[model samples]
Target chain A: MSHGRRQKPKNLLMILMLSPYLLLLFFFGVLPLIMAIFNVPTKSPSNPNGGWHVIKIVLHDFRLVPAAWHVLGFMALFVPLMIFFVVAMSLMLDTDTAPWKKWVRLAYIVPACISGSVAVLLWYVLLEPTLSPFKGVMHFFGITQASQIWKTSNLTYILVFMAFLSLAGQWILIQFGSLQSISGEILEAARVDGCTQFQLATKIKLPLIRKYVIYMGVLVFAGGLQIFVEPQLLNSSVYHGIAQQWSFDQLSYSLAFDNGNFGEASALSLMLLVPSLIGALLVIFKTDMFEDVNFKSPKKLAKEAKKREAAAA
Target chain B: MSIDFDKKAPATPEAPRKKKRKISIGHYAVNGWLIFWAIFSVIPMLWLILAPSKTDRQVSYKNPLSFASFHGYIRAWKNLQDFNSGVLAHWVINSVTYNLAIVVFASVTASLAGFVISASRIRFKKTFLISTLIMMLVPPVALVIPLFIEMNKVNLIDNPLSVILISSLYPFGAFLSYIYYSNTIPPEIYESARLDGCSDFGLYTKIAFPLSHPLLALLAFFAFVGNWGNYFMPYIMLPSPEHYTLPVGLGALFFSTPAINPGNGATSVPILKPEIALAGILVAVPVMIVFLISQKRLIRGMLAGSIKE
Candidate 1:
């Protein structure tokens, strides 16, 4: 009884601390998801069979295949390129011993500030042959007209380039920061064992920061799947209907707003949500992403270290 | 064995010398690569800044990298001011207000919840942590439609609170803070404070909150930048131009102007290329200012969040 009474106040404090975040999460995160799931038309004259019918309707929509292809193609191009370049650049930044590294890092993040509609606007100006700084290079490729660059066939590349510039810097910084977590002792030992710089980075540093890399991959893949802003801005602003409903998120938006089909929109959104949730869970549980977070007191840590030393002795 | 040892010893020094030469080459190569990418990353922003200084005709015909005159900037600003009787100023204010609210709410709640989750012996802590992780990963685009509907039902569709409240959830910030507090502040400090008669909330206020400046700054910076650049949420939630944030307002400006799309028939409005570029600069400047001021703290915060020990 006394123990139970003693525990009540601590639990109350925990509740007090957690309630604000929990409340916000409930209202914004969990509730919207629940509302979306329930908002899907389980029963209607067009779909008397209910849930499967809604899914079928969404799956069979004429725009679905094209939008799916666009998203898939984008992910195929954007995700791998982003991961490769970010990882490579970050690794290079980590290995390079130069005084200008700080300036380079700052420069990398400059484009990230220009994002969303602004990035699209900036890129439009940058790509327009008449106004582009790289017009000389564009002319070398025999491209003088914006039409050549803004064509439907080249959109995937354009979107990838825009997304890469805006996102790669931050990820490079993040991966570089993760690289900093690698202990110097390990690197010293590798060097002492006659490991070259290349071998040391590949064999030791790469393996050590594998989780952070995977984490980046998962995030990049998920964010890539929802490629909306660049294409949406391109479709609406620079080019008229050139990329209309070019992505699944855009399709969902049109379905909800233009068609006034909230049910179908909700269904489509839930479909996208499922994969992201599954991937997040898989990465969280299957990897050691959170494993190294030290929660023990210093005294307990010291005791464990002593115990390990005694055992080794 | 003695001959082999002597030979190896002599070769070792030479090998290091050769390796030193190779490393310098590699170092220069890396520097060149980073410099190239840096220029690529910064060119568009620099172009945007300088483009506004040229007239629309000059913007297209003149040297793309050259600056024309400050008169073009004054002309663009005047045109922007004339846009909808100066609605751009309202959008700027709205963006600042909404982002500030989001930053404050997100940072405070995230830190408090993170401290509790990491330090307190709370029940279902794993559940909370995993849910936060899942929430972090869930692409927010998936929730927009439902959230719009919910907001509509609550008559918050045109209200700024809808955008602010939804954005303030900031699961990524919460998760980052959780990771930071878990790894950074030792449990002994909390224990010692508690034993010295600090309450659970007191431990957070006294020990955790003051120590988490980098975390708080990071949370604020991210929440500010993410919401500041956010288009879809504010675009959907706030229907009126008066309440529009910078990105959405930029969208409106783009649609109205024949800046990028020459195909769109010319309007009487003077919102040509320079004006549009100026507006884009306006959208980017606040985040760039925040980034410049807090980049060091932002990096330290990122390191704290990602580093294990």
Candidate 2:
């Protein structure tokens, strides 16, 4: 990569181009993170014992741990729903099945296309304990009283519904897009070799698009952790467990703004960053998934092509 | 142009290899499931629109499915505009101002950062790129603790500038910018510009920036929506009543509503709940309008990188 004398000006130009970005990273990215780590050690009002104390407190707090687990557990309930939607949508949109797949794509994409705020507002109306049709059904079956519809006990159902409403469209869109990427010719080849639609989908399409699902899963899981506006807005009035700073995010909010405990809020916020960083690293290191999901792995595909050509020759 | 169009168009065969086909029972099951889910997704929106018309008493007395009186809108509108002699207007303006500054700063900075790192022969491009990934992966809540400390150190707590500055370094926007710059721009174009003696900034401004219109539009739309709908950060940063964003304002409104708190409803107390429908509409309008305007850019950008494989 060394440059000759002619490359001197090019090198200078490159250095000039990178200067602004370097300065921004130094000032914003590098500086703040260092400040945060530094601040972590001080025995602030938020963490009297110090940074490690705050971490241990957050880790050991029975409330925080289970609340975090509740989020995960709630998300787990939707696993089957996501699988059902993703696989069903993919199969429907696959080239072999449909002549007019465009309309199907539109249906799957529209829910995600709507704004999150709108989705939440809409869900509020549908889920309001007194008015929801499901409440009536529950009451009829002696399963739920009107007073207990969306209270703390059943808050999990509301959170699951909120997650599903906001994200179902997004997952469908990702899965459909991944499906559209698989070449029709390959499906046709499978068909010519006597692979049924189910067989082709199960054996071929499923394996090919497994990376996309994994990518979506990790991304959605991360998103589920950051559930804020929906729970804050929907569960604020009804559910007591949904404290001002219920989860890490809500708690951080209360710490900073509500309680004016900036130091504690910051500590809580730092705690929230750990899982997100892990998700990001998973994305970065998940090279097996990197190219397939985004169509960015053409370099590997090209190598495979050249090897096959050389072998044939 | 024709070649690109031909490629862009789905290459559906003119006709199916087989004749008229019978729709499968499985297809019915699929449609049934989708339609059922669609109804589930849609009914709530319909309720948001319908709920605002009724008073809390009317709302609770009757089934929620029924639309309440038209008076609810008048009350909700009054609450928004006439409450505290029109504080809601200021709240809206403050949100707009805060979000506008954030969108402009975040988009420009992200684009510049991404373009420079992607296009330039930076000494530590890998490090810069990895940092962007790390920052993107770090949850906003994690940054809140550090941000709060820094804001307080500067005496910026409860300041609009604090909120704006905190949101300005949007890692997601930066990631999008990097993706657009690295994937959309061709290296040969940079080489050509270099051969023509274009300076680095000149090349970016004259060539790369102009070519990145699609991404710029996409990022702008998303940046605005993210900042606009975001509640937790702004709720924490801007505590002043006048400076509240929509989400914060709505959260406060939700909290203050007495109708939600009337324990047992046996103890008679007039709980001041705004018409539920109108409140829903008010909270949702900013995002609804933005999505309607930018759906094209968003969908195009979304599908663009996807099809390249």
Candidate 3:
């Protein structure tokens, strides 16, 4: 209880220690947002109200929102698909310790470390009609132009391709970590109680890690909405189905960097910021997040396991 | 009458009357799926690596997967080196420099702030902490436009300082550090240290810093790998090829039109499609090596780095 009677730590030392983070937050996070809001330009007798005009422009001309919705819709479709794979893959890997499983797991996770752009580039080479690695398959299917792959009907495949390339390795690692946390005692009990494999996963494993799945789901949903590299890289290709501003981030990038319309870009950025901020807030307050994660040294963990094995024997 | 838990522990769901063949079928099924997935994940990467070694004709209109010639790879490497009078080499150097700076700055700033938040009594603790958590969640894309405007105002655009300075402010690294400290640092030690007349800076330098080796390594790796492969920031900030990182430079080469230099002093001869695949590998191989070396630790760090109890 004496912890409550401690002296206030409002001192220069405290500020000094935290100054780096504070400076960064102020300059990059807070200042940019403030500058963005004011940078928007509106035509008037007295100069004011920049963002509203751009907001209206976005709303009326359907510039930012429609572009955003396609990526948004792509995300909405792909996130669940990713969730299923994450769960299935994690479960399969965890259930057995087969010899080759180790190599397979590493292979699955390798794509995560490399940049998303690399995967896009890899696919870029593979999808070229004349230069595609799967030229034989394409010839067999009688597909002539590279443009045919990204038609509105076939756009889902591209989205799935990009999404899996970027999302699988990272999310799979997280889910696998959570799945491993389940105690062996509980698993043994469920198994002995005549629970089928499917029943065991649905009733036990899935429910136990529900929080992590939700956490990952919300993160992917917000993040997947801002996808840029895939569509942006594809700009050189013949694909017309994906809009110029295929993603909200790309829209902002093109608006400012390409069109040199800093004001409109700033306006569009603020508009997209609203939903992401809210989603973030919801996760922080609602989930059991930001809690401390205590780690044990590998030596200590091994010693404990040895002791448990001895006792069991 | 008591059944031993280990004896009854379920792995394969076997009935006493069931034949052994029935259980083997399930094993095959699981193994089959894993094999299929392994092939799916590895084949693309394999194609990328081998494609770089083939000529333009071999890559597109011919069998690209077959390893035909290191001559082709050597040719592409020479052309990349010779491109724009050795601009790609400069980009590689820039990437190395930027990565080192990002790792050092990000690790120190994030860990220091996280240490204070966890182990010391700081003013506006709640406000500062909440903002830190909230800011990390905001998509970086949402802020690029205004961030660019701010940089342009300061005349930091096209300077490595813009990327280097902002990379230090990484909110995710800060959050990861905070999580590490909160889990590892118990409050009683801080009180005892304070009572022992240990100064604030002394406590951090002597006690906290030594204890955070695992965390520092994790944060440093994430920072290095992330910035190493970052395409957008450098692309938007740097207008000239002289200041480009590998990813940004690669994007400029491949973004709209393929710009593979054909060794004829022409900047846009579009040397065989294999060159593009080679370019992807050039920027990515170093990162992949790091991931492989620290593969196990990488997974462990990710699991522990997140928000949890």
Candidate 4:
């Protein structure tokens, strides 16, 4: 890639270098999205006439508001708790001030390694009234059936929040890694300046890792809106009446699987697509994630800078 | 690189020690919060290990964290195997094949493309890189509808090939590999190899492959856990019972058991409740093991590409 003079990358080399990535992206991403839009069928699979009856659906018709209510209901507790526990656990793990650091760090990270349904089912069983291992405690409070709590009210939201607590291990690890990258000198200075532990956490470390926090924030937004597995698996007698279509993902899933309406399902998928794309764009534009990478090398950029100065002379 | 407080070691005593430094109540308060939440995180896992060891009735009655008889774990395992003609066995095999395929194919393509883009001369590099980022950001759900149809059109439906082809393109893996290479594969190595008359393929095989173990392990474990955990794609793509993965199979088990949830469609097949708990353990243990083994390498790999930038 290096040359005496800087030049744009060659077209052939780009094709050779990036074709696998581009192909996968096309097949799995761009092409699929385009085909989803084109999934409009001329006839229903059951229709014998095979007549031109292009399917049409509206995003507003999906009852997005109700779905949004459930989504936000889950997210309200989920996102803030994610941020709180992640920061708390990561700060504790990163600092030398904690006891049994290794054991606690391992325990905190165990949830991240677990997949979604397993974690949900584990929690589901533990919290179930008749199946709960915590039955003694629930009985002490006159709550015999764990399902009774979620049955009468929307207490499943709390269950969903508790289930997501384990999943925070992934983000905490990411943030912890970022925190580890901060220079020790800066923290020592803050400590020496009579900063309390809370002040050290909020003022110095949090500010420096603001970009990562933003990164996790946007991702949390995306993930919260698209929640599926927990609701799908939890939609049974264990926690009866936790709405099946709790999120748009579950909505679109049922729309496809139940009604066999890929067209409407595609529409629902696209609905989720818009905000996710926006959030990603915000992260890209608002953060330095792409700052260190570009087509031109540092040497080439420096050479260009020198050339500009010489031309001015 | 991980930060060391060595710089603070030297500068500490020079400051006035007049202000008595005691571990404040706030520090202990923070630790208390950390310890509480840390246990909060651990309790579910501890429950998973302990719950299945109790009888279904005992589970509802006993202290959740207590160890019950080992008989419960054994009986649950047997019942899980006996369910649906031992379909959980088939799900395990399918999961292994699918995850192994993803780990191999995804890693190879990702690393090769990553190496070429980062080290070799390439045109429209910025465009390629941006597109990869865009591809990564597009939530996987958005692709499900079209991919479902696409696999059907290609006659790959109900086939493992459907899942394999769909997962073959790890865009994030490629991005990570690109970052690892751009940062680790020094320009001098490339120059020296070229001077020694190394061909492009040879340089990659001889030089790059050997040096990418950390990245490779990181990507492999990532692919393993991601593919292992994934429920949606396989759920939609594979309609047949035999093609179900552990997650999908476990979902089927949850919905099938009656005592576990009497309200869930009559639970046609009678399955003990603890069997469901045991199955959850079965579903989780593989990924847990992978994470533990590759934990250090994965952390270092992530930090290498991320923190430096």
Best candidate (score: DockQ): 4
Candidate 3: tens digits of C-alpha lDDT, residues A98-153? 56776877787667755656766776656666666677788799876866775665
Candidate 1 vs 3: which has more TM-score: 1
TM-score of each: 0.91, 0.82, 0.87, 0.89
Arrange candidates, best TM-score first.
1, 4, 3, 2
Lowest summed lDDT across 10 adjacent residues in model 1 chain B is found at B1-10
Error of 1 at B6 (Å): 38
Please provide, for model 3 over B1-309, each residue's C-alpha lDDT reduced to its tens digit, 9 standing for 90 to 100: 011112223454555235335446776787788778777676677787888787777776567668978887888887677667778888889989988998999889999888877776555666776778678777676677788889999999999999898777777787777777777888788778888877788778877889999889888887877778887778777777899988877776664344322222334544445666777787878887787676655655555444232
Q: What's each prediction's clash count?
A: 0, 8, 0, 2
Best by TM-score: 1
- What is the per-residue lDDT of model 4 for residues B203-280, given as tens digits with 9 covering 90 to 100? 678888899997787788777777888888898899899999888888777766674576655433446667777777
Give the lowest summed-lDDT range of ten residues in model 2 chain B: B1-10
DockQ of each: 0.42, 0.32, 0.39, 0.48
Clashing pairs in 1: none
The residue pairs found clashing in candidate 3 are none
Q: TM-score of the candidate numbered 1? A: 0.91
Q: Which predicted model would earn the best lDDT?
A: 1
Ranking 1 against 2 by DockQ, winner: 1
Give the C-alpha miss distance for residue B116 in model 4, angstroms. Answer: 0.7
- Backbone clashes in model 3: 0
Against the true structure, what is every candidate's RMSD?
Answer: 5.9, 5.6, 7.5, 4.0
TM-score of chain A of each: 0.90, 0.77, 0.80, 0.82
Worst 10 residues of 4 chain B by lDDT: B1-10
- The C-alpha stretches of model 2 lying farther than 4 A from their native spots are A1-30, A45-54, A78-84, A93-122, A133-144, A228-236, A240-246, A250-271, A292-313, B1-23, B54-75, B263-276, B292-309
Among all windows of 10 consecutive residues in model 4 chain A, the one with the lowest summed lDDT is A46-55
